[model samples]
Target: MVDNRYTITVGTEQFRFTRDQLESDPGNYFATYFFGEFTEASQGARELVIEKDIQLFRLIQAHLRGYDIFPLPDAAVPPYMTKEVAIKNLRHDAQFYCLGKLEGTIKDLEQTSVKKEVKNGGKSPLARRYKAGECVISSYLQTWTFQEINNDGYQLMLDKLKNIDIAIPSRRPQVPGFSVTFCWVKENYYYALLVSDD
Candidate 1:
């Protein structure tokens, strides 16, 4: 806890830490860039003011302090909420800051989150775990095609499946994140076993 300190204000939120605290992490993007010769001002009031989401930055702070952001469960995470989205966003920020170690941790957490969500019916590209050789059945997903996630229209995937000559099974609305899904036809039915390109 050095006496020399500063505050990094991101949007409406402010975080205070010492130069020593940041330096202890060494390779963190904020630590490397701020204490180095390339630091720039995000705002001009004698503080590092950045225009970014405050909620996610708090998690970044947690990572810098050698801790995982807590009080947030991994299950039932959504894109709109911080707890569910923190690590992913933090990873993005980490990449920007060139925080290599933190990014590795975030990547690991992402893989774990994806695995846990698989049993709980979560559909994220990061969490859609599968391989090319494995034969997936309808238990994983129904045999249907989706297109343009933001504006999900049945395009090529649906069109290709339509031409295969089988019961054109009714499809539920596709989730809004993934762009492409890998599928296979087996046992006279189509199954969306693989999701999103690897």
Candidate 2:
């Protein structure tokens, strides 16, 4: 007989979460994946295999368990990864899971993280602009500008728009409303622009 349990495997890790625990949040992806009509046949099976990052999934699980995903203790994060990267990955996982609340928390953490980076002297030029409530956008061929939450968001966007170069002033601009532009020299031309508020 099939046991009354739900199992999820991400990478080399496996996690067990109850139906209620997964469904506690309305519109949660896990809830529907395990209980929705598509899952009727597997309701008895109650097992899911996700080809995603295990460490990131663990953080998502921690959030489900009511642990703060930000400012993660040194011991909680893997030795090779930085908390900033973890927070960034967590945002993606949260989005994939359709965990609205988790996404909200991630945004709050992003803002806080940017502030902390500035204080700790680990911030990029674009970071300060983001902290100032200014919007930044990246683009290729000068057609459309892609806007993200900043800091980690900027990095993620850049990764997606690979073969690009980022250029920001090393010294803080003394003037207000200064903008930074990131361009790249690839086989095909590409560019990303970040405009700050006045």
Candidate 3:
């Protein structure tokens, strides 16, 4: 028997599916067609990304259609936090987000310093943990210019300081919009470029 347990949230609506439902005709067709199109697409260097997104989309759809794709709770889940609330919480909780020009400068420099310590066997345990290549997420608020400066300087500084593993190197799009760019400073402290077209 195919296990098709999964959860899906569309806007404010949440739905769950069992394995049997996921394996049902409609669910399978949706999964197959969507993934088939994704796989057949001419992806140059972005094949992996395309595949990953397709898989995620399929899983979500499967869950929505009552497939047991994942072992989820039967209880009603809480509503998702609003985007503004989520962003606000992230800023409050993240260790690396800076508020002003001086804060941005100091944060980046401090992270760079930590990177140096990890390389030379310094005292920060967090730095050592980071040098080993772990996934981290942080949020911050800063002026657009500071964000740009951080983005420009990020890769060069990482190469100079750590000589350690870096995952998913920073990418800057040609499009105009607001987005955050993440980079390793030293070990624990990170430099984030918060851009806005406003």
Candidate 4:
């Protein structure tokens, strides 16, 4: 009987996976390459060779083998890379491999990370980009619009706010510290009008 084990050569590193494992996720890069019309046998190939980052590939393999791929424990992250870098790298490889599950997991990690960062007083992308003297408008905005986010207040905002985006606004230099010009609650939701004097 022919061996069903498949050898995957990624760069100079070599890893082995069973045929069933490689074909588990149909339509993914591996399944498409191995079982699609361009079968390895057609080219007399002994093993699958992928010219990609081996570190990312290793993480992908771990994920495929039922490992929780996101929010990796401290022990799992190498000394050379931070947890954030690992997540980003995995996100990149997951997209390239067309792994939907991994992609979804990464998104969840991102949201969780954002929440954690905010809870720990880390500045958000919105906070970093927003400037004094500029108006931020949202039709579906909330009362938390320009309210100062005390540690306790952030929990309330994070729980109630599903999404936020900046609509049309006047020009202002990007600066920290702003105030809410107007705020109101509408149908269990909140809206805000923010303006500041720089």
Instruction: Point out where model 4 deviates above 4 Å.
Output: 39-46, 74-80, 119-121, 125-198
| Candidate 4 structure quality by residue, lDDT tens digits, 1-198 | 987666789989988777667665555677666666666756755588878767667777887767775557766654455556667777887788878788888989788878987898876543432211222335653222233333323333433444554232232223245544433444434344333333
Worst 10 residues of 3 by lDDT: 44-53
Backbone clash pairs for candidate 4 read 141-190, 141-191, 142-190, 142-191, 143-190, 143-191
> Best candidate per lDDT, number?
2
Please provide the root mean square deviation of candidate 4 (C-alpha atoms, Å): 14.0
Q: TM-scores of all models?
A: 0.49, 0.54, 0.16, 0.54
Per residue, candidate 2 scores C-alpha lDDT tens digits across 34-125 of 78756543555577888976767787787766777666776665544556677667778778888988889889877876788778877553
Error of 2 at 11 (Å): 1.7
- Per-residue lDDT of 123 in model 4: 63
lDDT of 1 by residue, 75-155 (tens): 423334434345556668878877777777777877777787787776664334332222224566544443223211223
Order the candidates by lDDT, highest first: 2, 4, 1, 3
For every candidate, C-alpha RMSD to the true structure in Å: 12.0, 9.6, 20.6, 14.0
Model 3: per-residue lDDT, tens digit, 1-198?
A: 853444434444444554444344332332333333445323311112222123234434443354543222322212233222232233332222122332333346557766887788665422111111222334654222232333223334333445556543353223245444344443543343334433
Q: What value of lDDT does candidate 3 attain over all alpha carbons?
A: 0.36
- Model 2, C-alpha of 124: deviation from truth (Å): 5.8
- What is the Cα-based lDDT of residue 36 in candidate 4? 66
Full-model lDDT for every candidate: 0.55, 0.62, 0.36, 0.59
Better of 2 and 4 by lDDT: 2
